[model samples]
Target: MKQLLVFIRKEFYHVFRDRRTLLILFGLPTAQILLFGFALSSEVKNINLAVVDFAHDQATQHIIGKLQASRYFHLQQAPLSYAAMETAFRQGKIKAALVFPANFSADLGHTGRGQLQIVADGSDPNTASTITTYLTAIVGDYQRQLNQAAGALPFQIVPETRLLYNPEMNGSLNFIPGVLALVLMIVCTTLTSVSIVREKERGTMEVLLVSPFRPLLVLIAKAVPYLVLSLLDFTLILLLSVFVLDVEIRGSVMLLYGVSTVFIVACLSLGLLISNVTASQQVAMLVSMMGMMLPTLLFTGFMFPLENLPGPLRLIPNLLPSHWYYLVVKAVMLKGLGFGAVWRETLILLGMSVALLGISLRNFNIRLA
Candidate 1:
């Protein structure tokens, strides 16, 4: 009994002696809880909206005023043409566009009806769809207001909602792409982090550092085996998602794989960054879990919709590599989108990979120096 007690005390002492390990152990739960608690919201807010009102009438102006007054939407300058609106969406300047057709007031007064168009950016189908829903509800409210004032329901506003790409909403189809992202993140970040730290703990890292191999070559050699294994895992995931789960890939398979390859390299670079900072396998494991797993799963739109997150909290996912990967995967897999549709996200991931790899290599060189 005394021996067991003594061993347990010794283990606790060893664990507490490492300041990095101690910080992670104590800080992880607090940080994760705060982050997830604040970031996860059921309400969507701060949607950027553009209005194209060809009607130029009281009714159209009133509707535009209401949209601007709403807390959910931030109205931009009215677009002069459809081309301008498309450019805005492609440039990510707006999530939705409200178009009031010519003689909107005339149609409403004479025919008791008018057409309102809601064009949403389908790159993020979930967010775009939600924006349309909100616009529809607003128009309905306006119609109800007219009926109450006139003492009869005389006017109707018809909303033509065009959800580009994902005309048919499939929840499973959306999730399958996200699953690929999460799996790759786990394979690359967690496993590579632990393996690299294992070398450090085993004193093998010192021998490698002293050897004739260049630092970049040494890091690349260590990463090659893991990269191949991660690719194999990615292939298996793709097959399972398509066959067993019955999720169809509508886009170019080569494009999907190409984007995934870049993301894996980014995740691997992130792991190397963690491994470089950590001294032990245990610290690496904790850092990978606390830093990579929680944020990627909860905040990266992998398991939760980004639209539902709080306003300030929404910015965090943009920094995560998995966030862009999730967007690209969903766009390609569910929508059959080509490279042109997802080039922005692809470029962002590529940039993240290059930046993280550079930082990791610099840190490695410093450590050796």
Candidate 2:
């Protein structure tokens, strides 16, 4: 029993002596609590909207003016045609479109009723649904004002809400892409971290360090297998999502895979960075799980909307690789968007991959020195 106690004390002493391990051991849960507490929110605000006023009448103008007054929406464009509205939506400019038919004023004046068409880009079903509700409330308020002025029965505004893309509003469709993000996080960070640290623990890393190959080459070779494996895992998840889960991939599969490749590279690079800083497999695993997985789950806007989070917290998600990757996946998979639709997100992921890889290589060199 004394021998066992001594062994346990020695283990604790070793863990405490490694400053990085100690920091990770204490920092992970604190960070997770704070991140999850602050960042995960469901509210929507500041949605972009477009207007098409065919009537060009007082009532149409009044409705449009009311929408502009609301904090919930920002009027981005006034396109002349529905085609233009569709183009804007496909290009990811506007979330919703408000169309007033030619007879808007005439119908309202004659029958105490008006018709408004609310078209929402249903790629993001939650945001689209919220925008529709907001517009409906705003239009209803306008109708009430009309009735109050005339001292008559309540006027009615019929909202024809069209949800483009995802008319069904399937929750699973959104969830599957996020699941991919989590899987990638595990593969790139957790697996790679463990693999590299295992090599170090077994003295294989020391052997490679003395070999002719550069440290960067060794790190890259270590990452390539995981990169390929992560892609394979992504493909498997995608197939299962499509077949078993019945989630459709609306965009170009090739583009989705291409962007996914970039994200995988970024995540693997992040793992390399972790492995460089950590000396033990246990420490590497802890850092990867807590540092990478927790943030990917909470801060990436996978399960929660970043718009709803507090102002400073909103900026944090932008720095996470999974946030941009999830955006790209969601836009392409749900909206059927192509490269043109998601160039910004793709570029961000590409930039992150390069930056992280460069930093990891630098850290590797420093450790060698």
Candidate 3:
């Protein structure tokens, strides 16, 4: 028993001595708690809402003011015309829009009834559903308040809620894009990193480097097979999504594949960067899983509304390639958006792939020396 106790104490000392071990033991759990606590919220806040009040009447202005003051929404600069509102939605500027027809207040005053059109972006069904419900509740509350005051007539504000992009609100639509991002990243990054590390472990990597071929060419050659394999994986996922899940690729199939190729290249480049930095398979897996995988899972907006996250945490998703890829997939697959809608996201992914590949090649040069 005494010997066992001494051995346990020695093991504890060894654990504390290794910074990486200490981090895995303590830091990882703490970080998970902080991130999950903030990021996994169901209650969506800070919704960007656009209001078009054609009535310019007291009742319409009052409701707009209430929406502006509500914790749930940030009333965007009111779009002047229907054309402007459509433009905002297409550009992904606002999550929901409210439109009050002309003579809105007069109809409410005389007939004790009113009509309001509420338009929600339904690409993310959950957020769209929640915002519509919340907005309806707010409008209902105003009607209730009027009825309670001065023994007024029963006032009714009927909201005609229309869900754009996904009228049926099929939950599958939301997860398909997210799954593509998650699966491709995990498979490509883990497989590529593990494969390269395996080469290093088996001593073949040094053999390949010693050849007369350029180091960059060798690196690309090593990555090429995995790149092709990852694309095949993507193809399989797309087929499953289309047939099994019945989620149609609304945009051009060529455009979808084109954007996905960019994303896959970015993920492959990331894996190369990981392989170059880590000497062992264990370290590479840890970095790939804990470092790359966690960010991809958490920062990708499909898992939750980005608005729920705090200010500093919000910036994390912007830095992640998976997040951008997820957005591009949603725009193309769900919204039927053309390349014009997704050019910015595609450009960013292309830039990241180039930068990561460049760095990995530089690291290989240093290793060769």
Candidate 4:
């Protein structure tokens, strides 16, 4: 027990003594949380909307008034023509354009119907979809109110939307889990890889291997401390996400921890594999950044939606552990799903961990051989 405590203490000393490792362990979580919470959000607010009202009538004025009243859109410019609207959008001054035809009021008054063209920049499809929905809802509500006043329709088509899990649909709630997975991967994998390769670079790995302690035991001792630290980091992130950002975990906390544990193991095993294969710390760092970090960021649906990606790019997420982790996070945090709901993802992570461990162990044996 004393020896184990001493080993753990040594691990802590090594971690604290190196400023870079300490920064990666502690600083990264805080920075990532702040970044995701503030900078990275899917919810669009105050979107610049250009309006071209050729109608020049009360009906068009009313519609524009309603649009400006809604907080989702900010009326930026009143362009005269479609060309001007297109130019404004191209220049990135506006995200969407509202065009009211010249005969809007006359047609609506005489024929009970008119057309309003909404041209949205489809470059960011998600934002475009959201803005379109908001505009439709507002216009529909206004139409319904007008119909009610005229007693033309007995029944109304009220939008009955039941948002599953996350009723508020806060993007932070959706992002927190992914960020947690990413931060843990970066810390655990990078730390383990660097630590192992540092020993190799310092010519101490051979000395340690030749010592009385078993190699596997030494590996376990080195890794166990990091496992504990990763858990600590996970807990801190979870707490901050919930209390600070108002992100809730609708599913069981135990389930989240369980899934996260498997993912962490897989990530750490990958680091071990890299550490065993690479001869220097620089190589390990480069390999991890190129092989793990880039793939995880691009394919895991962290910054971009998987659905928006092309077919070939979509398949890439299947190869990454972070993709599965992101799904688990979304299910638990946003969908409020139980174990049964995320069983497939959990199994995938488990399988990945087992496979990585097996590969890492084989490589360790090869190194010994």
Backbone clash count for every predicted candidate, in the order shown: 0, 0, 0, 0
Candidate 1, residues 197-295, lDDT tens digits: the string is 777788877886786545566567657655765677677766766665556789999998899999999989988999888988888888987888888
Q: Model 1 off-target regions past 4 Å?
A: 1-170, 365-369
Candidate 4, clashing residue pairs?
A: none
Instruction: Choose the strongest candidate by TM-score.
Output: 4
Q: Arrange candidates by lDDT, highest first: which order? A: 4, 2, 1, 3
Model 2 has an lDDT value of 0.76
Runs off by more than 4 Å, candidate 4: 52-58, 77-93, 101-103, 117-133, 153-167, 298-320, 365-369
lDDT of 3 by residue, 147-222 (tens): 7774655443434343422234455567667767876786668767876787788887787677554556655665
Worst 10 residues of 4 by lDDT: 158-167
lDDT of 4 by residue, 285-318 (tens): 8888788887887788867788999778778888
On lDDT, the leading prediction is: 4
What's model 2's lDDT at 129? Answer: 84
lDDT of 2 by residue, 145-234 (tens): 777787766434434343422234454566556767877787678767777787788887777778665666667566766676677777
What's the true lDDT of residue 25 in model 3?
Answer: 37
Candidate 4 lDDT (Cα, whole model)? Answer: 0.82
Give the candidate order by descending TM-score. 4, 3, 2, 1
Q: TM-score each candidate.
A: 0.55, 0.56, 0.57, 0.81
Q: How close is candidate 2 to the true structure, as a TM-score?
A: 0.56
| lDDT (Cα, 0-100) at 187 in candidate 1 | 63
